[model samples]
Target: AQSVAQPEDQVNVAEGNPLTVKCTYSVSGNPYLFWYVQYPNRGLQFLLKYITGDNLVKGSYGFEAEFNKSQTSFHLKKPSALVSDSALYFCAVRITGGFKTIFGAGTRLFVKA
Candidate 1:
Protein backbone atom coordinates (compact mmCIF):
# COMPACT_ATOMS: atom_id res chain seq x y z
CA ALA A 1 0.00 0.00 0.00
CA GLN A 2 1.22 3.49 -0.90
CA SER A 3 1.02 6.18 1.71
CA VAL A 4 1.85 9.89 2.04
CA ALA A 5 2.77 11.77 5.17
CA GLN A 6 2.99 15.43 6.10
CA PRO A 7 4.74 15.56 9.44
CA GLU A 8 3.91 19.14 10.26
CA ASP A 9 0.42 20.10 11.28
CA GLN A 10 1.11 23.76 10.53
CA VAL A 11 3.85 25.98 9.20
CA ASN A 12 4.38 29.68 9.94
CA VAL A 13 6.45 32.13 8.00
CA ALA A 14 6.77 35.88 7.70
CA GLU A 15 5.60 37.52 4.53
CA GLY A 16 8.36 37.58 1.91
CA ASN A 17 10.21 34.73 3.59
CA PRO A 18 10.56 31.27 2.22
CA LEU A 19 8.21 28.46 3.26
CA THR A 20 8.15 24.72 3.07
CA VAL A 21 5.60 21.97 3.75
CA LYS A 22 7.30 18.67 4.35
CA CYS A 23 6.12 15.45 2.73
CA THR A 24 7.33 11.86 2.75
CA TYR A 25 6.07 8.72 1.07
CA SER A 26 6.20 4.96 1.14
CA VAL A 27 5.42 2.95 -1.98
CA SER A 28 6.21 -0.33 -3.64
CA GLY A 29 7.51 1.17 -6.88
CA ASN A 30 7.96 4.52 -8.58
CA PRO A 31 5.26 6.95 -7.53
CA TYR A 32 3.88 10.30 -8.58
CA LEU A 33 4.02 13.18 -6.18
CA PHE A 34 1.54 16.04 -6.07
CA TRP A 35 0.88 19.15 -4.05
CA TYR A 36 -2.50 20.76 -3.66
CA VAL A 37 -3.71 23.84 -1.83
CA GLN A 38 -7.19 24.29 -0.41
CA TYR A 39 -8.55 27.69 0.44
CA PRO A 40 -11.45 28.20 2.79
CA ASN A 41 -14.69 27.06 1.16
CA ARG A 42 -12.81 26.21 -2.02
CA GLY A 43 -11.83 22.97 -3.66
CA LEU A 44 -8.31 21.68 -3.65
CA GLN A 45 -6.22 23.43 -6.29
CA PHE A 46 -3.34 21.69 -8.04
CA LEU A 47 -0.04 23.19 -7.18
CA LEU A 48 2.70 21.02 -8.68
CA LYS A 49 3.70 17.46 -9.44
CA TYR A 50 6.67 15.15 -9.83
CA ILE A 51 6.06 12.58 -12.51
CA THR A 52 9.55 11.92 -13.83
CA GLY A 53 12.56 13.48 -15.59
CA ASP A 54 14.15 16.23 -13.50
CA ASN A 55 14.37 16.14 -9.77
CA LEU A 56 13.00 19.63 -9.55
CA VAL A 57 9.37 20.06 -10.50
CA LYS A 58 7.60 23.40 -10.74
CA GLY A 59 3.90 24.10 -10.62
CA SER A 60 1.23 26.78 -10.19
CA TYR A 61 1.22 29.82 -7.87
CA GLY A 62 5.01 30.12 -7.84
CA PHE A 63 5.36 26.79 -6.08
CA GLU A 64 7.92 24.07 -6.68
CA ALA A 65 8.82 20.65 -5.32
CA GLU A 66 11.98 18.59 -5.21
CA PHE A 67 11.86 14.85 -5.63
CA ASN A 68 14.43 12.86 -3.69
CA LYS A 69 14.40 9.16 -4.39
CA SER A 70 16.79 8.03 -1.71
CA GLN A 71 15.08 10.03 0.97
CA THR A 72 11.63 9.17 -0.31
CA SER A 73 10.62 12.77 -0.02
CA PHE A 74 8.95 15.43 -2.16
CA HIS A 75 8.91 18.60 -0.18
CA LEU A 76 6.99 21.69 -1.42
CA LYS A 77 8.73 25.03 -1.36
CA LYS A 78 8.20 28.74 -2.08
CA PRO A 79 10.94 31.32 -2.06
CA SER A 80 8.68 34.15 -1.03
CA ALA A 81 5.66 33.81 1.18
CA LEU A 82 2.45 35.83 0.89
CA VAL A 83 -0.45 36.23 3.27
CA SER A 84 -2.71 35.28 0.43
CA ASP A 85 -0.84 31.98 0.22
CA SER A 86 -2.12 30.95 3.58
CA ALA A 87 -4.18 27.81 3.20
CA LEU A 88 -4.35 24.09 3.82
CA TYR A 89 -1.83 22.10 1.79
CA PHE A 90 -1.96 18.42 1.02
CA CYS A 91 0.64 16.00 -0.31
CA ALA A 92 -0.40 12.99 -2.33
CA VAL A 93 1.20 9.91 -3.83
CA ARG A 94 0.12 7.41 -6.47
CA ILE A 95 1.81 4.35 -7.82
CA THR A 96 2.91 4.19 -11.43
CA GLY A 97 -0.20 2.36 -12.53
CA GLY A 98 -2.46 2.79 -9.54
CA PHE A 99 -5.84 4.47 -9.46
CA LYS A 100 -6.05 5.31 -5.81
CA THR A 101 -3.98 8.20 -4.55
CA ILE A 102 -2.96 8.43 -0.91
CA PHE A 103 -3.13 11.88 0.68
CA GLY A 104 -1.56 13.34 3.77
CA ALA A 105 -3.61 14.65 6.64
CA GLY A 106 -2.81 18.21 5.45
CA THR A 107 -0.65 21.04 6.68
CA ARG A 108 -1.96 24.53 7.24
CA LEU A 109 0.37 27.32 6.19
CA PHE A 110 0.25 30.67 7.90
CA VAL A 111 2.00 33.56 6.23
CA LYS A 112 2.06 36.51 8.56
CA ALA A 113 2.62 40.07 7.54
Candidate 2:
Protein backbone atom coordinates (compact mmCIF):
# COMPACT_ATOMS: atom_id res chain seq x y z
CA ALA A 1 0.00 0.00 0.00
CA GLN A 2 1.08 3.57 -0.77
CA SER A 3 0.30 6.43 1.53
CA VAL A 4 1.40 9.93 2.50
CA ALA A 5 1.34 11.69 5.89
CA GLN A 6 1.46 15.39 6.51
CA PRO A 7 2.28 15.68 10.19
CA GLU A 8 1.13 19.27 10.50
CA ASP A 9 -2.45 20.41 10.35
CA GLN A 10 -1.37 24.01 9.90
CA VAL A 11 1.68 26.20 9.65
CA ASN A 12 1.97 29.89 10.51
CA VAL A 13 4.65 32.27 9.31
CA ALA A 14 5.28 35.94 8.82
CA GLU A 15 5.11 37.38 5.33
CA GLY A 16 8.89 37.67 4.99
CA ASN A 17 10.00 34.58 6.88
CA PRO A 18 10.76 31.12 5.58
CA LEU A 19 8.24 28.31 5.81
CA THR A 20 8.12 24.55 5.56
CA VAL A 21 5.39 21.93 5.38
CA LYS A 22 6.56 18.43 6.20
CA CYS A 23 5.50 15.25 4.41
CA THR A 24 6.40 11.57 4.42
CA TYR A 25 5.32 8.59 2.37
CA SER A 26 5.29 4.84 2.17
CA VAL A 27 5.18 2.82 -1.06
CA SER A 28 5.93 -0.61 -2.45
CA GLY A 29 8.07 0.28 -5.47
CA ASN A 30 9.72 3.30 -6.98
CA PRO A 31 7.70 6.32 -5.89
CA TYR A 32 6.45 9.27 -7.89
CA LEU A 33 6.14 12.22 -5.55
CA PHE A 34 4.15 15.38 -6.13
CA TRP A 35 3.14 18.57 -4.30
CA TYR A 36 0.00 20.57 -4.95
CA VAL A 37 -1.49 23.82 -3.74
CA GLN A 38 -5.17 24.70 -3.45
CA TYR A 39 -7.17 27.82 -2.87
CA PRO A 40 -10.65 28.11 -1.45
CA ASN A 41 -13.10 26.11 -3.59
CA ARG A 42 -10.46 25.71 -6.31
CA GLY A 43 -8.85 22.61 -7.71
CA LEU A 44 -5.29 21.72 -6.78
CA GLN A 45 -2.45 23.19 -8.81
CA PHE A 46 0.71 21.23 -9.46
CA LEU A 47 3.59 22.71 -7.53
CA LEU A 48 6.34 20.18 -8.25
CA LYS A 49 7.21 16.53 -8.78
CA TYR A 50 10.09 14.19 -7.99
CA ILE A 51 10.20 11.19 -10.29
CA THR A 52 13.92 10.44 -10.14
CA GLY A 53 17.46 11.81 -10.27
CA ASP A 54 18.00 15.00 -8.33
CA ASN A 55 17.21 15.00 -4.64
CA LEU A 56 16.38 18.70 -4.71
CA VAL A 57 13.39 19.71 -6.85
CA LYS A 58 12.12 23.24 -7.34
CA GLY A 59 8.58 24.33 -8.15
CA SER A 60 6.14 27.20 -8.62
CA TYR A 61 5.74 30.17 -6.26
CA GLY A 62 9.34 29.90 -5.08
CA PHE A 63 8.68 26.53 -3.50
CA GLU A 64 11.05 23.55 -3.48
CA ALA A 65 11.25 20.09 -1.96
CA GLU A 66 13.93 17.60 -1.07
CA PHE A 67 13.47 13.91 -1.79
CA ASN A 68 14.99 11.79 0.95
CA LYS A 69 14.83 8.16 0.03
CA SER A 70 16.24 6.70 3.23
CA GLN A 71 13.86 8.69 5.41
CA THR A 72 10.93 8.27 2.99
CA SER A 73 10.26 11.95 3.23
CA PHE A 74 9.63 14.88 0.88
CA HIS A 75 9.41 18.22 2.68
CA LEU A 76 8.35 21.46 0.97
CA LYS A 77 10.29 24.66 1.62
CA LYS A 78 10.55 28.30 0.66
CA PRO A 79 13.24 30.91 1.25
CA SER A 80 10.77 33.67 2.03
CA ALA A 81 7.05 33.42 2.56
CA LEU A 82 4.40 35.77 1.23
CA VAL A 83 0.88 36.70 2.32
CA SER A 84 -0.40 35.49 -1.03
CA ASP A 85 1.31 32.16 -0.38
CA SER A 86 -1.22 31.27 2.27
CA ALA A 87 -3.19 28.25 1.08
CA LEU A 88 -3.76 24.55 1.49
CA TYR A 89 -1.02 22.13 0.47
CA PHE A 90 -1.25 18.46 -0.30
CA CYS A 91 1.45 15.85 -0.80
CA ALA A 92 0.80 12.89 -3.04
CA VAL A 93 2.47 9.67 -4.11
CA ARG A 94 1.93 7.29 -7.05
CA ILE A 95 3.17 3.79 -7.58
CA THR A 96 3.29 1.66 -10.71
CA GLY A 97 0.25 0.00 -12.24
CA GLY A 98 -2.28 2.45 -10.89
CA PHE A 99 -4.10 5.51 -12.15
CA LYS A 100 -5.03 6.62 -8.65
CA THR A 101 -2.85 9.01 -6.70
CA ILE A 102 -2.88 9.01 -2.91
CA PHE A 103 -3.04 12.44 -1.33
CA GLY A 104 -2.41 13.61 2.20
CA ALA A 105 -5.15 15.12 4.31
CA GLY A 106 -3.66 18.56 3.59
CA THR A 107 -1.96 21.32 5.55
CA ARG A 108 -3.14 24.88 5.80
CA LEU A 109 -0.40 27.50 5.51
CA PHE A 110 -1.10 30.90 7.05
CA VAL A 111 1.25 33.70 6.15
CA LYS A 112 0.55 36.80 8.19
CA ALA A 113 0.96 40.30 6.85
Candidate 3:
Protein backbone atom coordinates (compact mmCIF):
# COMPACT_ATOMS: atom_id res chain seq x y z
CA ALA A 1 0.00 0.00 0.00
CA GLN A 2 1.08 3.55 -0.82
CA SER A 3 -0.21 6.79 0.63
CA VAL A 4 0.71 10.47 0.82
CA ALA A 5 0.02 13.16 3.37
CA GLN A 6 -0.02 16.98 3.34
CA PRO A 7 -0.05 18.06 6.94
CA GLU A 8 -0.99 21.65 6.33
CA ASP A 9 -4.35 22.61 4.97
CA GLN A 10 -3.04 25.97 3.82
CA VAL A 11 0.33 27.63 3.41
CA ASN A 12 0.75 31.39 3.47
CA VAL A 13 3.77 33.19 2.10
CA ALA A 14 4.76 36.65 0.99
CA GLU A 15 5.51 37.35 -2.59
CA GLY A 16 9.17 36.99 -3.54
CA ASN A 17 9.77 34.83 -0.48
CA PRO A 18 10.52 31.17 -0.39
CA LEU A 19 7.68 28.72 0.08
CA THR A 20 7.36 25.09 0.93
CA VAL A 21 4.46 22.63 0.99
CA LYS A 22 5.29 19.64 3.08
CA CYS A 23 4.48 16.10 2.05
CA THR A 24 5.25 12.65 3.40
CA TYR A 25 4.57 9.16 2.19
CA SER A 26 4.24 5.54 3.24
CA VAL A 27 4.67 2.65 0.87
CA SER A 28 5.35 -1.04 0.89
CA GLY A 29 7.87 -0.87 -1.91
CA ASN A 30 9.65 1.82 -3.89
CA PRO A 31 7.48 4.92 -4.26
CA TYR A 32 6.82 7.31 -7.09
CA LEU A 33 6.20 10.81 -5.83
CA PHE A 34 4.64 13.73 -7.66
CA TRP A 35 3.54 17.31 -7.16
CA TYR A 36 0.63 18.99 -8.86
CA VAL A 37 -0.95 22.41 -8.92
CA GLN A 38 -4.59 23.21 -9.53
CA TYR A 39 -6.02 26.55 -10.47
CA PRO A 40 -9.64 27.53 -10.07
CA ASN A 41 -11.86 25.64 -12.47
CA ARG A 42 -8.82 23.97 -13.95
CA GLY A 43 -7.43 20.48 -13.97
CA LEU A 44 -4.37 19.49 -12.03
CA GLN A 45 -1.11 20.28 -13.78
CA PHE A 46 1.98 18.18 -13.37
CA LEU A 47 4.72 20.02 -11.55
CA LEU A 48 7.39 17.41 -10.91
CA LYS A 49 7.99 13.75 -10.22
CA TYR A 50 10.47 11.51 -8.45
CA ILE A 51 10.90 8.09 -9.94
CA THR A 52 14.64 7.43 -10.10
CA GLY A 53 17.99 9.14 -10.33
CA ASP A 54 18.44 12.50 -8.65
CA ASN A 55 16.92 13.05 -5.25
CA LEU A 56 16.45 16.72 -6.11
CA VAL A 57 13.99 17.03 -8.98
CA LYS A 58 13.11 20.32 -10.64
CA GLY A 59 9.71 20.92 -12.09
CA SER A 60 7.79 23.52 -14.08
CA TYR A 61 7.33 27.10 -12.91
CA GLY A 62 10.38 27.38 -10.73
CA PHE A 63 9.23 24.59 -8.44
CA GLU A 64 11.32 21.73 -7.16
CA ALA A 65 11.24 18.84 -4.69
CA GLU A 66 13.72 16.63 -2.92
CA PHE A 67 13.13 12.94 -2.49
CA ASN A 68 14.27 11.79 0.93
CA LYS A 69 14.15 8.08 1.35
CA SER A 70 15.17 8.08 4.98
CA GLN A 71 12.51 10.57 5.95
CA THR A 72 9.94 9.15 3.54
CA SER A 73 9.20 12.63 2.33
CA PHE A 74 8.99 14.62 -0.88
CA HIS A 75 8.38 18.25 -0.08
CA LEU A 76 7.63 20.87 -2.74
CA LYS A 77 9.63 24.06 -2.74
CA LYS A 78 10.00 27.35 -4.58
CA PRO A 79 12.89 29.71 -4.02
CA SER A 80 10.70 32.74 -4.60
CA ALA A 81 6.98 32.75 -4.70
CA LEU A 82 4.70 34.83 -6.90
CA VAL A 83 1.13 35.88 -6.31
CA SER A 84 0.25 33.93 -9.38
CA ASP A 85 1.61 30.82 -7.70
CA SER A 86 -1.24 30.82 -5.22
CA ALA A 87 -3.26 27.72 -5.86
CA LEU A 88 -4.17 24.31 -4.55
CA TYR A 89 -1.31 21.86 -4.43
CA PHE A 90 -1.36 18.14 -4.05
CA CYS A 91 1.17 15.47 -3.18
CA ALA A 92 0.71 12.06 -4.69
CA VAL A 93 2.35 8.67 -4.38
CA ARG A 94 2.26 5.42 -6.30
CA ILE A 95 4.15 2.31 -5.43
CA THR A 96 6.41 0.73 -7.98
CA GLY A 97 4.41 -1.34 -10.48
CA GLY A 98 1.15 -0.10 -8.94
CA PHE A 99 -1.64 1.16 -11.12
CA LYS A 100 -3.30 3.44 -8.59
CA THR A 101 -1.98 6.79 -7.52
CA ILE A 102 -2.94 7.98 -4.05
CA PHE A 103 -3.20 11.72 -3.35
CA GLY A 104 -3.26 13.85 -0.28
CA ALA A 105 -6.17 16.05 0.69
CA GLY A 106 -4.39 19.06 -0.79
CA THR A 107 -2.96 22.30 0.55
CA ARG A 108 -3.99 25.73 -0.62
CA LEU A 109 -1.10 28.14 -1.10
CA PHE A 110 -1.58 31.86 -0.65
CA VAL A 111 1.20 34.06 -1.94
CA LYS A 112 0.44 37.63 -1.03
CA ALA A 113 2.15 40.62 -2.50
Whole-model lDDT, candidate 1? 0.95
What overall lDDT goes with each candidate model? 0.95, 0.96, 0.96
Candidate 3 TM-score, C-alpha based: 0.98
Tell how far residue 23 is off in model 3, in angstroms.
Answer: 0.2
Report the poorest 10 consecutive residues by lDDT, candidate 3: 1-10
RMSD of 3: 0.6
Tell me each candidate's TM-score.
0.98, 0.97, 0.98
Q: Report the C-alpha lDDT of model 3 over 1-113, residue by residue, as the tens digit.
A: 66788999999999999999999999999999999999999999999999999999999999999999999999999999999999999999999998899999999999999
List model 1 lDDT by residue over 13-32, tens digit each: 99999999999999999999
TM-score of 1: 0.98
List candidate 1 stretches off by more than 4 Å: none
- lDDT of model 2 at position 86: 95
Candidate 2 C-alpha lDDT tens digits along 7-102: 999999999999999999999998999999999999999999999899999999899999999999999999999999999999999986677899
Residue 18, model 1, lDDT:
94
CA deviation > 4 Å runs, candidate 2: none
Pitting candidate 1 against candidate 3, the one with the higher lDDT is: 3
**How far is 92's C-alpha from truth in model 2 (Å)?**
0.2
